[model samples]
Target chain A: MKTVIIKYNAGNVSSVSFALERIGINALISENAEEIKSADKIIFPGVGEAGSAMNYLRQNKLDEVIHSLTQPILGICLGMQLMCNYSEEGKTNCLGIFDQNVKLFPLSELKVPQVGWNTITDLKTNLFSGIIENEYQYLVHSYYVELSAYTIAQTNYGISFSSALNKNNFYGVQFHPERSGAAGQKILENFIKL
Target chain B: MLSKRIISCLDIKDGRTVKGVNFENIIDAGDPVELAIAYAQQGIDELVFLDITASNEKRKILVDLVSRISRQVNIPFTVGGGISSVEDVSVLLNSGADKVSINSAAVKDPGLLKKMAGQFGSQCIVVAIDTKFENNDWWVYINGGQINTGIKAVDWAKKITELGAGEILLTSMNNDGTKKGFAVNITKQISEAVNIPVIASGGAGTMQHFKEIFISGKADAALAASIFHYKEIEVLELKKYLKNNNLEIRI
Candidate 1:
């Protein structure tokens, strides 16, 4: 199966490719619209500001290619945030795949960007197959998608939020499945099998 | 709920692990990649590779090592030591390092932190601060704790946070290498001062110390080097102990 990782100006594409490699899949990292459109699976990975990322996608015409893709697509971290309708970060608009809005966590006792490992609960969809409920996943982000109908998994950090989202062929996870240990690897494996 | 992180630090020199690691299953303890995989298998939440190599070719070697570790290990790791400029951070992060920690360089030119945080988001930029308690205050130290900057640790932590640091890896010079325990007082103070996560380093001797740093120290994570290198406390056992103690630890 041909798996292509959508690489724009975002970070963490190499790490995601390596994770796919560990799972025995040599995924291609590409920004070319034709290359990404022709893949069996596409993984959208990002770890940078939303506005700039969106600008890069638009400038390279990747935004149109991504919105028109019909294959199983997975978005991780900032990529997941950009999958929503809008993001509070940089007041940028994103792909309307999930119809969710990304908002920053309110300043409180808990840290802004909830770094380190956090548990994902209420697991649903094939993306979490072979993964247990409340399994730990590594995450690093300041903004989060509020709990919505598309939320496949939930995690609490001041409030309940969508740790993983699924709508049709599109899958998005706020955590880094590539960086998450064995359970995370399993999620990636399941995504591939899907 | 977010679980407290347990990180293992490996000192790298010329692309090799400095402190000899003796894991029973490890074939080449000198190899940082092998050692990193071992630690990840033992359920280590994160790993930090402090590259202490001072050669002109250090960047190339360090980047190669980072790429190797990223390919082999399926966990987040930070590459630090001798990273001063945006170019250094760019190569390391692009090479698959999850985060890059800046120590003395950040202190020398605080603008570097802002520039790094702006270029590469704050989440990927970790500011490592080494401090010592003197004159009834925890003062920031640089150059691997060889020079005291005379700035208060708490003040510096708050400054860095405002300057766009995603996390603070606070190491207590007094507590480091002591193995007695972490400096809970200063750790709590700094953790409270900053809005970001504080990774308390130094003075972690026992599993109880880990529990203390989380409970009393309010440290979001705890880092130790020698004790883990010496095999005095295993990562899995320590996590189980912390879990039993009612800490939100990933086991």
Candidate 2:
């Protein structure tokens, strides 16, 4: 199946393409509206600043393109953060897909970027089909989205936060499924089947 | 809960895994991709590939190696050695590396860190600091530990984080390949001084060495080469041991 990954001025876009390739699916990465709207699935992924990323999406009008897509869409990491109503990082507004807000991890003795494999529990969607609860997934983020009604998965680091968000046809995961091993692959594969 | 990471470091020379003492007297270990897959099956938390090769052509092969490993393994992959510019970082990341570690080139142009952080995001920029104890202070070394930059290791660690380094791969030259133990003093120095995660590399002889570094050094992660290269210590057993010691481990 053909998938279109919404491209922006962010890093790690290559990894998403490579991950799709490994799963035997060819993905087109583009910022063009027509390419994104016609795809079977649209994956919006970003690994850069929220303020500038929102600016890029707004300037290219990708923000509107993403909101109008009727097909399934997946937002990863900063892309997921951008789907929220707003973000404390860079004090920028987001696409408002999940009806939530993003905030920096509360100040504590813990490291800023939760950079490692951690267990995810309380799964609430088919995004984790065939995946056992408390299975570890790789994550690296300095900010987190508050637990919202759309939050399908939750993880704890100093405090519980939304690790995965699902609302209607749109799905967002704060962790990098491309970087996580078999468990992560399972989640992506499940998404493909969805 | 956050778990302390155990990183398997593969030193690459001509695309084959190699381990050297004090960056000399090197010996080949095995194929890079093969060993990488083996480590992943053994429950390795992360894998680091250091391109110790000097030639530009060899750097290309290193990139190729990174691409192959990224396709084969799903763990966090980091490569160091020869990333001098944002383009180099892009090539490696595009090739599937989650992070690119900067060493000599970063010291040569301190601005590279800031630029890379701005372009690729700080989480992907890993600053690898090679240090040696001298005159009651740790000094930064470059060029395979041959040239001393006189930049104190602790100060450089703090500076890189401020400049937008997401993590630090702190290697102690004095204890490297010695298997004595990690330079816990210097590790603790940098780990405490910086808010970002510090990966303790260098001497790792036994499971206790891993425990000591994580406990006393306050290191977020510990990396070892020959110990894992030769299968002298199994990664699963070590993780179990660390977990038994009341430390958080993925296993």
Best by TM-score: 1
Error of 2 at B243 (Å): 1.3
TM-score of each: 0.99, 0.94
Per-residue accuracy of model 1 over A65-169 as CA lDDT, tens digit each? 988999999999999999999999999999888999999999775697889899999999999998998899999999999998999999999899999999888
- For every candidate, C-alpha RMSD to the true structure in Å: 0.8, 3.2
Q: Taking the tens digit of each residue's C-alpha lDDT, what string does model 2 give over B220-249?
A: 999998887777888899999999999989
For each candidate, how many residue pairs have backbone atoms clashing (under 3 Å)?
1, 0
Share of native interface contacts present in candidate 1: 0.85
lDDT to native, each model: 0.93, 0.87
Give candidate 1 misplaced runs (Cα > 4 Å).
none
Docking class for candidate 2:
medium
Docking class of 1: high
For model 1 chain B, where is the 10-residue window of minimal lDDT? B53-62
